[model samples]
Target chain A: MPWGKQETKPRLSPETIDYALAKAVADGDIVNLRQLFAPASPLRAWSPENIYSPKYAYLLPPSEQEGERLFQEALALVRDPDIAEHARAQLEKDGPPQLHAALVMTLADNAVRLGKFGAAAQAYEWLRVRPRMQEEFLRQGDTALDQNDIARAVAAYHAGTGLAYNYAAFPEPLPAVPDYQTRALILHADYPSTPENCVAMQDPAAFIRTALSYVFLDAETAARLDARPLEQRIAFTAAFVRRRDPDWDAFAERYRNTCTFVTAFGRRLAQDTPPAEAEDGGLAEEIEEQQATADPREIEARLLGRSIPEGEWWQYLKELAYEHPAAALFVARQSVGHGVEIVMPRLREDCPLVEPLGLDVTRTSRP
Target chain B: MNDAGYVDYFAALELTAEAKQGEVRKNYRKMMKDLLLSIGRERLTEEKRDRLLLDMARLNAAFYILRDNERRARYVEDRRRVIALEEEWRGLAETGGAGAEEARRQFDRAMRDFLTTYMEDLVLEAGRDRECVEASNWDRAHERHAGRVLRHDRHRHYQKILERLPFHEVTAPRVNWEERARVVDAILTEATR
Candidate 1:
């Protein structure tokens, strides 16, 4: 209907629609522009050829210049509220033949920008159902993709190209613990008092889930985690990440050196520096020179020697295993003492402690 | 009245969803008379007359679908999914916890599937009806599907979508959930309307 040959004279003179459009454009009259641009508008019957034909040449811009001016002016008034309201009214009217896919799409977008969500939805639903709009809708989607507009691309492709909703739509990682207090309430556990690791260190289940989502599981898999109890899932994740690293001792030695240096340096800096003048270079140089005299074993003991409850580190270690498996393996190697090569392999090969997690960890992992 | 893009053929003919074949025929005649009266009152050019015929063809298509009991039942079953998703979306919005993102994802998938399937049905039905095919200029055999046209149309829609979702990054597929949420919220408004 937007274009075709005119076999007979139009009911209204070409001047009627042209004059109306020119007036609307000149005055920035959004209401008239909305009606004039509508698919069902009598103006639609006047294709470029028809408007420029000898019969209507008097109404034409010398070479379509006048038409271009009107189009430019209409473009200038596109975001007007009256146009949006007219679009909304048409959508509410729910006439299938009157709706234009591109026009409605533009107005729907304006509604979204204006925070008129209800109006935008109306346009989306209109575009969604019309088979005639399929080609146009796909065009909208393709255009969005070409521009690298992922969210808009996803929206258009979902409605137009039938692109399925997937984890790819959610490219950003969700908060590690979206709402800490709500999760604690759900688990019926006490909230952690210390601030450092908070939920990640205190609750194994929470830590494992967040770590898996961040580093392993796709959004779909992470969202639909098994309904298993917390401890069981933690045990499962711990075993999953517990591969036998061939260079475990070497990695552990490096970690021990880093930890020792960090702990000793931290203590010296805390004692020697005033809170307000903490960045004083002279004090830092003197502490670094004095650091070699301090015993590494003694410093390690002083910092890590506090009696941790038996199960307090249990969850924290499992979480560590997910993020830094070597760290957890180092703790295990120290506890098992010296024969870890034999013990760890045997544990992996023979242990029936954890049930199969029954998940694909490689789904979103890079090839 | 148009729930989830389901064509209320019954409403098209001024009948209820439960209308039997006899009631459909009775109402179709009455509706046709009213349409003809309106068309007669207007002085139509050749193109305008053809355009108006599409309204008549749509009414005919509605009758075509509803006259058959099996098709009408299938229509109801299909529409039910859209309505169900609307309810599910509402519940997810209210709960607002871990399930929120996943639920919204599922709602989007269902809505897309329903709309695609419904559009396919409309296309297929129109293909079969001579009046609709003529009025709509729908060539079922030679029709360009989204898959075929996407290579050409992609650029245009991309610009449109970018304009709608402002400040969009053109390099990555990372979604701005807030902007996407507004559009989805608008879509839900229409679905529930």
Candidate 2:
């Protein structure tokens, strides 16, 4: 229990294993994934056009001179903490600069995952200093509420409302998303919530610290998202949804590298199963339950198809974020590498037209 | 920075203009003599003399404006018509830019809080290098820090909600609105102490 870089422990469940792999990439544990998948052919096609690229490794420089040059640039960046600070300062002095904010946050977040705590703190600290629309919101809230513009009012109300539930209720670690209510208004920075808009971040810790990230009225959204994840996903379905130009068939039929699997350890999970075809892993159990209970076809018809009207999927996500902040946090918090796999592959069965456009229905069987 | 002395140089001269030109010249001379006499004592250093010369120039400019009754009367009327109108542009610029800079400052403050909390347990490795006893106690501490981070992060996010507003720094602790009024006196006593 003395914590000085003890050997990594055996993963608890297949789900945990998937969580680890996803986390490896998210945490920038690129070499760890390579070690995990060392036996597999590295150059294999994750898709027809692309190789199964890993996040950790890069092409070795042709000359040591080139390597040294790259090293020096990184060294310069690291040797001075104020580089980021000054960059952020310039961004504030300038326009609504998105690139610096996103890049700094990502870089610092990635750095933390790579075990650079102090640097990460500085980066996060920098983002805290920018202008947000909360004051205009307080002034605007009265008019918005009076005007009967629910979206506008909701946006304003969140800026001024002093609800205390945000950090008082839930304590952390039991659930990935903690539950809490705000002592002040919940933020809505990216106001005019278009489909493309990034949701103004809420303090997940307010929920997590208070244990508010868990406990859902609907148990389905209660499914905890592993912050440290294993696996990769780029759903054709999501691409379809995200598309400004609504092209359905083009998305489903497309197949890309949106799948991940475990290496040698993954096959061991199947050992517990009677046969390769038998669905006995913990994942199978949940899928079986979901299939038996919540029909995918119905969910697709009601949620995704053209019938239920505009922002249907978007609304579902909002409701999920509202009723189950943790679940929303789970999705919100998802790193580029980790998340759930298709037990039933509802996107394929429901949106068959989309499948032909190249749906990467890669069943991430534990390697 | 020292724009204050230039005030009403011409107008003041006009206000007392009805006196004869000879008397006016005498009054101006007397005023200059007094002004010079007031600052006459010096270290006799060249740098000190130059500093006095700037002051002398400003007085001369004021007298030049005031010596003519017509111009002085116009200046006097102008002063009455407006309050501190000379430095209005600088004041406005400072107000606008400072407001903008302040919002940016607050946003950065909130961002740090978010990063600290979101990456808390992960970066800190809650169980590692942490001094404690008992698994349950460790768990509780982790949870406490973890939750605190989140709460702080939420505060950061709310800051973003208010990001565009002129930042009114609430240095006072969160107390009832009634208690807020007493804050100034409390602060004043502490400042003196």
Candidate 3:
């Protein structure tokens, strides 16, 4: 209906419908072709001389039936490698740009509908590279989701981004859908890990604070954990972190060194010295000297010794763990004395105690 | 207090008509307790006991009548009509028209009919109230429980009505018929808006 003028005399003629169907197939107007070839319509009898003309040569169904029926047949054919291969070859020898794009999109959509996700994903990849077909990619993505195909869905949604500016303007624009990026991150991977994918972890400090929430603790023991004495809490967290670490030996030292560097670097960065002046002055030299000479253990001790308010130290440690699991584990090991195992024995070893903190600890580790 | 035998139930409960439902129940409970305590401490001379019983019966009757929203609304409407009728009679008498006496007689007949109908309702209401009070007392004795009291819904209705009044007039003690009608009109206007 949005395509306009269903009753236009010239557009409604059988000849016009045939031309239009071909044009629609050529133009990637799958929606229009669907409407034109609806059941009980004369256009349903029209056949175009394209990749869809031959029975085995077709990528899509060539029968003079309704569009949906044609689509169903096409979806079935897409599952057959020989038929699919024939269709792709015909599409490559395209007479019209519209036909080529339309055939590609139809194949992708049919592939998605038929639960052929790999084929759908490949077709969608091809469609995305073509001109002005971002919305088609989005449609394919949504179709993929309807079939419960997550990989293609993530690919499609990710492709739709940065293409919003190409669409027509609205009078009263709505707020952009929230959690699109988050959804992509979730579907693309198990959780936010890399810096580019994990938008929430851009701020290492904030990410650390959120990681300290009761989400990480067992629901039944969360209240008791909160009530524990500070020393006990530290010891409990240390054991929790170590047990969770996949490679505690490699992580422990790296974490400690990174935290020390982050703290000292943050301190030096916060100083009022301007960049130009700092380059010429001893400030840069002093920071470099400290970075080289300061024992991470002493820095960790000094940080822990400071009168951090109750509950804040755990939060700081949790945040550190999220951004740098090793750092958090190292801090935990140092605080509670590594010998004590605080968590229950029955807890699943494979299950992560906390969500991936999605922070880039390596960036801060660099001098 | 008006000619319609419509006593201010709010006044009987020792409250302003604007009192909230919670306030009404709290004050009603306090009043009932105080009345019962006073009656209990007194020497049970037959005459004194009969008088205390009558007072307790009146308190119970007033509470029952006021607590029910539909009955209270009907009572308020009747009171307003009685005031209107009285004003009409006074105006007719001042003119001293030929049919003024006939009009006055018709008005008295109407009042009698209204009173008869209301009296029947009052008798039934009083009987229901006595049963309710007895049942409540029995329950309290057996369960050692203070039963939940029904709250007057009219307080919310009255508050909403008051909100329609002019800002300065909303808290005023007295509101005339014209001001009240205007407030109703304001409510209608706001609802349409």
Candidate 4:
């Protein structure tokens, strides 16, 4: 009535809650932020500014407001080591369907990045039954492989195959770590039982580094190690360095030098190779070609022939005894059975070969 | 003269006798799946249900016998005997000597008796192994499971005998012999194994 002045006031709307939440997040008010996004809170109903209306529904579906909040919370939790337990606890608990799914996905991604593959696999297992998470299962498998959880990786890949409609159409096949290779990695003295160690064994530079540390430390020997392929280098190192050193003292000295050389050589090689090629392209094609052409049977025969001169035939026989006891026994029988005169000189006597063959050497040696 | 004594596990499983272990397992899975689907539909007449049930029993028995290498070896041995006896019975029947019919009847009874005993023993052995597994003793369970797998690789020492035996010829009415075999199969299937 007085008409002294016209006064205007800022109006509060549904989005004001989101604006307030964002402010609290930016201010690092974790408690207030969590409360605003809690399932029972009225603020959880507030949608993002870019939500699709009925008129523009074709553009994109509306983002679930609760999922957005949960995703933000997960991001914050991942950064804070102290409150990370709460993040994991929240993930384990039930919440809004969309938020629960989003939280799990976030946790899975974070776990994979942090190399906590077991936790990542658990999260992916929960997501596996849900729609639109086939790729997540594949990621879980890859993460499992990084941890050398072969059985779990295989299971994840199988589950992913079941869920994915066009999985066959994908350009690249899933990576497979064969059983024998897994066994070799586990049993090999020089090779630490880690997937990263197995992967590093594939790199020529990495092979050189490992060889220099374990076998020969000279730059000339390291260069020679680099010239040959990684598999050959690994085989050579395993045969010459690891197996030949009878005593641990000699092995310890060799191992110490190899370690020192590996640190220096790895840095040098990293600088030599371009980041792009190192990351994606180099040596993969060459390695694939070598593997495609290599015959395992031929390699085994060659290795067997080579073992005779090195006086390592007994060691080879010992290794074979566990896997092919019948074959070993047959060889032992041939050496000492009806025609002992024919085969005795040919048989290696360094180790009691008959013992590993599961035969009594003294009894078998008699005609 | 009936094919009752000459039941080939391969023929029962709708596979070649020379089928590998993988093929045997695959056929078994497929046959089981189809039978289960039909049985689940609940649309069969009583007679049809009985026939299907008997077929299912035969299928199960055939798989068990053929899947284990040791059992398969024994089955192969018995099959050889049946072939030989059939051959001898055929020659006698064709010659038409005095008491030829009685001689043939003896041979037939001998063959039938052998088959019955062999099947009984198999079911009993499998039952004993199943009991070991059921006992929940991990060591015995592991040993039993491992023994079953190892039996898969048993050398076929009786291969020469298998090759020497002539292919069995069916002489009885198809439906009658099939019904008789089904009855035998049902008995074996219901055995504790």
Candidate 5:
């Protein structure tokens, strides 16, 4: 034979399809049932939803009338009370590999068509694809949420997403008159802030960063917060604040004012610093002299009416602000929109003026 | 109690304080049903949805206190204390007499107790945002930067929960304790005792 050998394929005729289904039902032959609904068989037309369509359009090669007749006949047989009872009894017993998988799939497809998604999902368990199960559940959740059925939505979301904790697990339809405990539980869940999960913040770094930038913490505590590894930030902050027992509003505001001073003074110092690089030769010496005169101690001495040799100004101011918030607040308040000259004159006599009078300076200074 | 720092639950539910238990229950159910129906019927924006949720939560809180006999009695008693204290403080400054200083000291203690209650309540309300982030598993929702933005939005939405609170008015300038104390002092001192 010059040509390739030809093999005859076994095709299922209508009579064979009918006889196979009847025998399977009567004998409880699930393997026969599997074969009938297998993708290679004509009976695969039964589930239109599972068909990929257009790309796998060839799967529906059977004419429309033929497909419909086969489906209607099979459905009628399965819907029969004696047959269904027998199939249920058979499913409970030990059976072939992938036993009744096709039977369950048919039931699922029918459930889907009837818009009974919950029942459909139950049937789909026989197919056993986890991702598909999750998708079905999430979809159900979204539907329930839209319908304003929060109880159903919460349950579906929990099942679909595998939430580690349930936020609101109150009784369904909500009791018309709940007991004290139930009301408390509902309030705890619905209220925006609960102490239930204080041990962990969603993003401690982001929160702490905001606090630091906003100057919601003192320089020392801010430094402490900065040094702590990412995970330990929230607990440390919560504990630190708890011990101080300071009113948070007052704390936040005091730092915010100090920040205003530090920022403005920092900018003034930046503008006064020698901008030209030291490598620029002759100007470098001039800049060095400028830095000398710019020194913080010299500025303080000059402010106190005592002349002193100039020194490095910018670095001193920054370190002073970082070390002593009182000095920063003092300079910030006195030197608003003015040069360093305007504020330093009273350091000797009015230095007592900056002694934090009624202000709680301990909050800003290092503990 | 149309004042900024107080909530009148009876007024919130559109009922007088003297409304019977049956009336309170009937109104709550009707309002809740309407709220839920509106949610279902409307295609709500994120902002609108948040507003609705907050309204629902506030409604729940109010109903919780009013529905119970013991809670309702306690709430009514607490409200009376606030009113009487405010009246006494106001009366001090208007009718300053021989014992004014002692009256002022008494008023200060009462004010601190009121402040403590409100501050704790505000903290509880603010803690909601953290709980929400945990529940939604929002940290893993997107890449780092995008996720942070979403979290910020979430926090801002939760902040509105605090804004709705009456205590925020009293603690408005949260930072300046000196000024706050002065103002509080002024309220009590300048009043006609």
Candidate 6:
């Protein structure tokens, strides 16, 4: 009989599992590392009393678990003043984990030199904590809520607010789509689309089903991610500036504008552009220039006009309507008379139908 | 070999329409053994022999149908839809064109695939080709069954004649015609029944 199933089994201490996992990782045993970090690991939920000791150098791998939870906590530990001294002392012998770690470590040092406290905090924290966080965070529930636990997204929407990271393991959605294709999915909530995040999108059904998964994420992100293919979402977001008010020459103003973030504390963060590098990129535009344009009706209607992701804009608009009914009517109207003028035709891969859409309208609307 | 004239040969032989060529040989061998055992070797009147012969012929027909995969496949498919069609025709004066067309198409497709797999043709010419050779094989089987029964009767008749001669009387041979009367009566009874 299985041990857990036994009625008279002894209660296992959560700390014992944590120590074993730490020791296993320290021993450079991948098999033991996997078992220690398995789905039902006893160590996962426990908060660490002393996490950033360099003795715990085994905790250095962040990109593995899709930047999910346990790893995020490991990120916070390196920033803890209590453990920083110990971690630095051990780094002398063990060295940092790898080159990426070295670069991030150097980057954090650069942040300290520049005296950008928030940036330096995140940079230093990522160097110390994120590696550990990545070491053991992939096996939360089969799926992560974009950010909100299912308990929240359920209150407002039934369809996509919560997505199953692996649908075969957890199946739910309207259009009954799986959550694999989704990313940074909820409002401030995020579902990273690392190759690991969407292990199931490997199936063809996920292409459309996951593309349809925005049934519950916020309108901007849903509008941002839905209707477009993955490669296209990247290109579209490449030009995306999350903020609007900052000037390139001014750091104080830019930092003030750029400072709004939702997920983690500075020390817990990693991967994004450092403050120094971002200074050259300029802060995201603050004022709504698109809203300020000479034509407001033209802009509103033209918004959903060019197709969101790929194939037909009408179809994507329909998915948008299905995903966010509260926003769909307004978005759907954009696909109406707003065809040629505001369409970002340059986004052809995502908006394959814009040219065909214009020609369709020209051919039909010529009465 | 129980071929009540009203019943079809395949049904009389207790065979499904889908029975394949090899299955026919398997089923027929067991069936022939049972029938001959039940009837027993006996001298029979001509009428009794004629009835048995007719029954044997029908059995032969059933074996032919089962021996060819193509015919059997079509027979199985047609038999399934035939009931649905007859019921529809009986229930309404007008057969809906679409429904009829669909059923017809399904039947046509199944038959074509079956024929292509087994006989390579649907027409009567298909029966004449390799399938005819198949039918003749079963016909030879029936003749063989009749021959065996005839030989058994002669053997029993001679044994009965020898037993009647007494050991003390040299060359004693009974002239009583009733000596084999029982074997003859048994055959006649089976014919009328």
lDDT of 6 by residue, A82-118 (tens): 4433333332222211112322333332322222223
- Tens-digit per-residue lDDT, B1-193, candidate 5: 3244445678767899888888876776677678778888999875576566555544554565677788788777876775566556546645755544455456545544543332223222322434323322223322232322323333343233334322210111223435423432332222212
Q: Report the first chain's TM-score for all candidates.
A: 0.25, 0.19, 0.25, 0.21, 0.19, 0.19
For residues A325-353, write the lDDT of model 1, one tens digit per residue: 32332222111111110001001222222
Q: How well is each residue in A269-339 modelled by candidate 3, as lDDT tens digits?
A: 32333223334434434545666764323443332333233333334444344433434222222111112
TM-score, one value per model? 0.25, 0.19, 0.22, 0.22, 0.23, 0.18
**What interface RMSD does each of the candidate structures achieve?**
14.6, 18.0, 33.2, 29.8, 29.7, 52.0
Choose 3 or 6, whichever is better by TM-score: 3
Record all residue pairs in model 3 with backbone atoms less than 3 Å apart, i.e. clashing.
A26-A98, A26-A99, A27-A98, A208-A319, A255-A326, A255-A327
Best by lDDT: 1
In model 2, where do residues sit more than 4 Å from their true spots? A1-132, A146-302, A306-367, B1-131, B140-193
Model 2 lDDT per residue over A1-367, tens place? 5877554323233332233333333443334433333323122112121122244233222234233432334334423444344433432333332223333433433443343333433443344421122223334544543454434433332322211122222332111222222210132212222222222122322322222112222122112222211110112112212221235333232212112211211332222222223443444344445456532222322222222333233343444334323222222111101121211112223322233234434522222
DockQ of predictions, in order shown: 0.01, 0.02, 0.01, 0.00, 0.01, 0.01
What docking grade does candidate 4 earn? incorrect
lDDT of 4 by residue, B1-193 (tens): 3344355678877898788888887887687678777777878864465455445544555777888888788888877766666677667656655555555566656664554444333433433443222322223443333332222111111222223332221111122434423432332222212
Cα lDDT computed for each candidate against the true fold: 0.41, 0.32, 0.39, 0.39, 0.39, 0.32
- The local distance difference test score of model 2 is 0.32
Over 4 Å off, model 3: A1-367, B1-5, B45-47, B113-120, B130-193
Worst 10 residues of 4 chain B by lDDT: B150-159
Task: Give Cα distance to truth, residue A361, candidate 3, Å.
Answer: 99
